[model samples]
Target: MSARLEAINITCRDHAASGARWAEILGLEPEGDITSANDFITYRIPGTEVYFAFQPPDNGEVGDTFVPRIHLDAVASGNTREQELENLLTRGMKLVVDARTADGAGWFTVEDVDGTQICVGRSDEERAAAKAAREGSS
Candidate 1:
């Protein structure tokens, strides 16, 4: 079958703005140049990598700013989503949404520096608790 995301792509009206914000917020360096108009500024989370493309925006308005709506989520891997959440929030990220499953597992939604929606999840503490519960049940 066809697989999961190789890289999630986001297009921003101002690549420089988004790239800079993400860099500061995520505490991750951009994988490459953040200057080229046609280039994608990248960020790698533990498991997934997100790339944001800087391009001219269509004439839409986000409360008077013509920014794009290319929202992307930087999901945490390796069971450290709680820590990841703390790290991101400490860097000025704002919680926008919180998602959960029928099994009570999922991610929290946060808005990035550019006002793009980002979904973050539980950290090591929650993961460990879940894992232990699973083991005890088994």
Candidate 2:
């Protein structure tokens, strides 16, 4: 049997703050009480079965050596890529990398408040459609 993806658990020094920041950035409402330090806060990406959960460190401390290697890739929704990038910046994400293709499709890598790198971009289909629309309008 094939295993299905469930949830991505993130260890945070301050789960509440990280949860709040992520909720605002993703335009998602948190599922659990962010104020409760004993429980994890979860955000389910819209139109998907996947979930992102933020929880405090198990040892009650996030050491200086702790560095996250995994980065999340998210598609832009409900807004243009530029608008989404602007929103991310306004919500306190630091810009890391911004790249684009000749067709005007692009992606941005931003570091969240908790220092997790998240790449936000458009899909190949979306890029093709956008390019077609632009050509038609010209």
Candidate 3:
């Protein structure tokens, strides 16, 4: 049987700092403190069951270290896109770029504290479709 994913673990130079950054960026709540006994801090994103664990680098050469190749995508209400984007910036995310699609939809890319790129926002059409789906279901 196939299983569901629960959490994603990432390595950084400092787990606590990374965890704190992620907590603020994603509106998550960290459950444990990163310590010598447990070198990880698990942060759970609210309204979801997923968790993200941040830890220190594994054994390797000075220059050879864990570089995450993952990217995260999130959807926001069309009207709240600007507010959410501002919140992400306030939480230490660096904006890479922002552009509008041919259909006049907008999207942006930002880098997290660990340099992991995350894409937030959606095209205007996509936002409208999502809203329509939600309203139809309700």
> CA lDDT of each candidate?
0.60, 0.70, 0.65
lDDT per residue as tens, model 1, 1-138? 111232455666665677678768767556666566454566554444444444445553334566455655454655466666676688788977767666648976667777866665554456678899999999
Evaluate model 3: give its TM-score.
0.42
Q: List the candidate 2 regions with Cα displacement exceeding 4 Å.
A: 1-68, 123-128, 131-138
For candidate 3, the lDDT comes to: 0.65
Residues 5-108 of candidate 3: C-alpha lDDT, one tens digit per residue = 35566767666787888889889886765454256788887878767877666663225555544455554443455566787788898999886466536667
Residue 83 lDDT (model 3): 62
- Give the per-residue lDDT digits (tens) of candidate 2, residues 1-138: 111234566777777788779878988656656566576788887777667888777666568855434456666665656667788788899999988677677777888887787777774456678888989999
Model 3 regions more than 4 Å off: 34-38, 60-66, 69-138
Worst 10 residues of 3 by lDDT: 1-10
From the highest lDDT down, the ranking of the candidates is 2, 3, 1
With a 3 Å backbone cut-off (N, CA, C), the pairs that clash in candidate 1 are 81-122, 81-123, 82-122, 82-123, 97-109, 108-120
Task: Report lDDT (Cα) of residue 47, candidate 1.
Answer: 45
Worst 10 residues of 2 by lDDT: 1-10
